[model samples]
Target chain A: MTDWQAFFIALLQGATELFPVSSLGHAVVVPALLHWAFRQADPSFVPFLTLLHLGTATALVILYWRDWLGIVKGFVRGAVRGRIEAENERLAMLLLAGTIPGGLIGFLLERPLKALFATPRVAALFLILNGAILLTAEALRRRSERRDLSREEQEQQFKSAQQITFKAAFVTGGAQALALLPGISRSGVTICGGLLAGLRHQEAARFSFLLATPIIAAAGLLEVPQLFSQRGPLALYAAAAVVAGLAAYISARFLIRYFRAGRLDPYGWYCAAFGLLALILLR
Target chain B: METRGNPALAGVVAALGALFVIISALYAFGAVSFATSDPGAAHHYKHALVALAIAVACLVAANVVRPKAA
Candidate 1:
C-alpha cells in the first residue's frame, strides 16, 4: 500500500464511521468501485481496519474529553459505593448497557457476515436499505413530541443522557448490532432506537456517539495483538490512524451541529443515490 | 458541544482536506521518490508508491465530492 492509499482509506474511515453512514459499506464499495489491488481478507488488512476504528474512537474521546472524564470518575465512585445518583454515573451505566448488544452480535456473527456479504453488490443493496431505514427513522422522529430541537430548547428537553432508561439504551445497542451487516449502520440504528425511545435528534445522536466509543475502541484493543504479530504497513497504518482521527474530529463537529437543526434526510438521499449507482455500475 | 454551525471551521477543514489531495497527487505524479541500495526492494517500493498515489487520487476525488454532514 502507498502513503496516499492509506490516507485515502483513513479519510473515508473518519468521515463515514460515525456519520450514520456505514464505514464498512464504504470500505466494501469504494475499493471495488475504484478497482484497487487491495485485499480485505489479507492478514495485514484486518489490523489496519482495527487501527482505523481506534482512530475514530480516539476522536470521540478527544472531542468529549470532559464528559468522559466525569463519567470515568463518577463510575469509580459509584462502583465503590454500590450506588448511582449523579448524572455521570447514570450515563456511564447507560453507555455500558448500550454496548452489550452490538458487542455480543459482533463477537458472535462478524466473521460469517463478512464472509457472506462483503461483496460490493451486497453492500450496495444494504446501503439502499440503510437509506430507507434512516428516512423512516426521521419520519417517525418528526411525528413525535420529541422532534429536532432548537439550540435553546435542547437544554430544556433532556437534563442529561442519564434521562434515558438503561433498558432503552440496551435495546438501542441491540439495534446497533444490525450493523454486523456491511451497510447496516451502528450509529443510524442506535440513533433511530433513541428516537423511538423519545429522544430528540441531538439527544439521540449524543447517545449514539457515546454508545459507539467503547465498541469501536474495544474492537481495536482486541486486534492489537494481531497488529504486533503482523508484518505490514506499520508506519502507513500509524499515519492512517492519525489522519483518520483528524478527519473524524472534524466530521464529528459537523455532525453534532447538523443533527441539531437538520434531519438525516440528506444522508438518506446520498445512501440511496450512491447505492443505486453502485448497483447499476456493478451490474 | 459544537451546537451551532460555523462556516469558518468548515472552510478550514475543506482546505486542509484539499491539501492532502494535492500532496497525494504530486506523489502519484512522481514528484516524490525514494532511494534504496537494494535494487529489487527499490523496484517494489517504487511500484507500491505509484500504486498508492493512484489510489489516493481516487479517494481524494471521492472525499471532496461527497456531501458534507451539515
Candidate 2:
C-alpha cells in the first residue's frame, strides 16, 4: 500500500472501528470500490492490519484509562478476597464473561470466516445486512421503550453499564463474535445486545466500548512480533498506526458524547446506502 | 453475617485454566502441534496468545467464585 493509501486506510480504521459501522467491511469494499491493488492475502497485510488495530486499541486504553484502573484495582481486590462485591469488580467479571465467548469464537473461526466472507462482494452484502441489524435493534429498542413500565421497572431501564448482570454482559460479548463477518459491526451488535439487556443507548454504547478494548488489544498484541519480522515500510506502517490511533481517539471521544442522545439510525442508513452503492459500482 | 463460596467450582475452573496454560506452554515449546500441519511462528504465537487469554479468564472466574471467609 502507498503511504497515502495506508494513511487513508488508517483513518478509516480508526473511525469505523469505533463507529457503529463495520471497519473490516469498509477495508475490504472501499479498496475494491476504489480499485486499489492491495489484496487481503498479501503477506505483509495481516501484520499491517494488526498494527492499525493496535493503534486503535491504544487510543481506547488511553481514553478509558480511569475506568480501566478502577477495573484492575477492583479485580485484584476481589481476587485477593475471593469475592466480587464492588461494582468495579463485578464489572470486571462481567467483561470477562463477555470476552470469553467472542475471543474463543474469534480464535477458532476468524480464519474460516474471513476466507469465506472477505470478498468485496460478500462484504458489501453483509454491510447492507449490518444496516438491517442496526435498524432492527433500534426498532426493538423503541418498541421496548413504548411499553408502560412499573415504577421499579422504570428505574431498571436506566441501569448503568456497570450495573448490568453477568448474563447480559456475556450475551452482549457473544454478540461481538458476529463481527467476525466482514460487514458485521462489533460495536453495533454489542450496543444492540446492551440495549436488549435494558441499557439506555448511552449506557449500551459505554459497555460496548469497554467490551471492545480487550479483544481489539488482544488481536493486535498477538501479532506484534510479526510486525517486526515482516519487511517493507516499517516507518510508514508506524506512522499509519499513529494516525490510526489519533483518528480512533477522536472518534471514540465523539461517540461517547454523541450516544448520550444519538441513536444508530444515521449510521444504519449510511451503511445500507454505501453498501448498495458499492455493490452496484463493484459489479 | 457470613458469606459462602463455591470451592469445588473454583477448583475446577482453576484446574481448567492450568490445563490451558500447560497446553500453551507445550505448543510454544513444540511439544504439541496446533491446527496447522506445520505451524509456523505466527500460528504458534496466535495459539499461545489465545490460550493465555482463556487461562486468564478461567483464573479470574475461579477467583471471583471462590470467596474468602469473612
lDDT of 2 by residue, A139-257 (tens): 88777664686534543566788778777887889889899999999999998898888887778887898999999998888788787777778788889999999999999889888
Tell me the tens digit of each residue's lDDT in model 1 across A114-190. Answer: 77898899999999999999999877766654447664474356434668876698799888778978887788888
Off by over 4 Å in 1: A146-160, B1-70
Q: Give the TM-score of candidate 1 (chain A).
A: 0.93
TM-scores, each model vs. reference: 0.76, 0.90
Each candidate's B-chain TM-score, in sequence, is 0.42, 0.79
Best by TM-score: 2
Q: Which ten residues in a row have the lowest lDDT in candidate 1 chain A?
A: A151-160
**lDDT of model 1 at residue A211?**
85
User: What are the candidates' interface root-mean-square deviations?
Assistant: 20.1, 3.3
- Could you tell me the TM-score of chain B in model 2? 0.79
lDDT for A209 in candidate 2 is 88
In candidate 2, the residue pairs with backbone N, CA or C atoms under 3 Å apart (3 or more residues apart, or in different chains) clash, namely none
Least well predicted 10-residue stretch by lDDT in candidate 2 chain B: B34-43
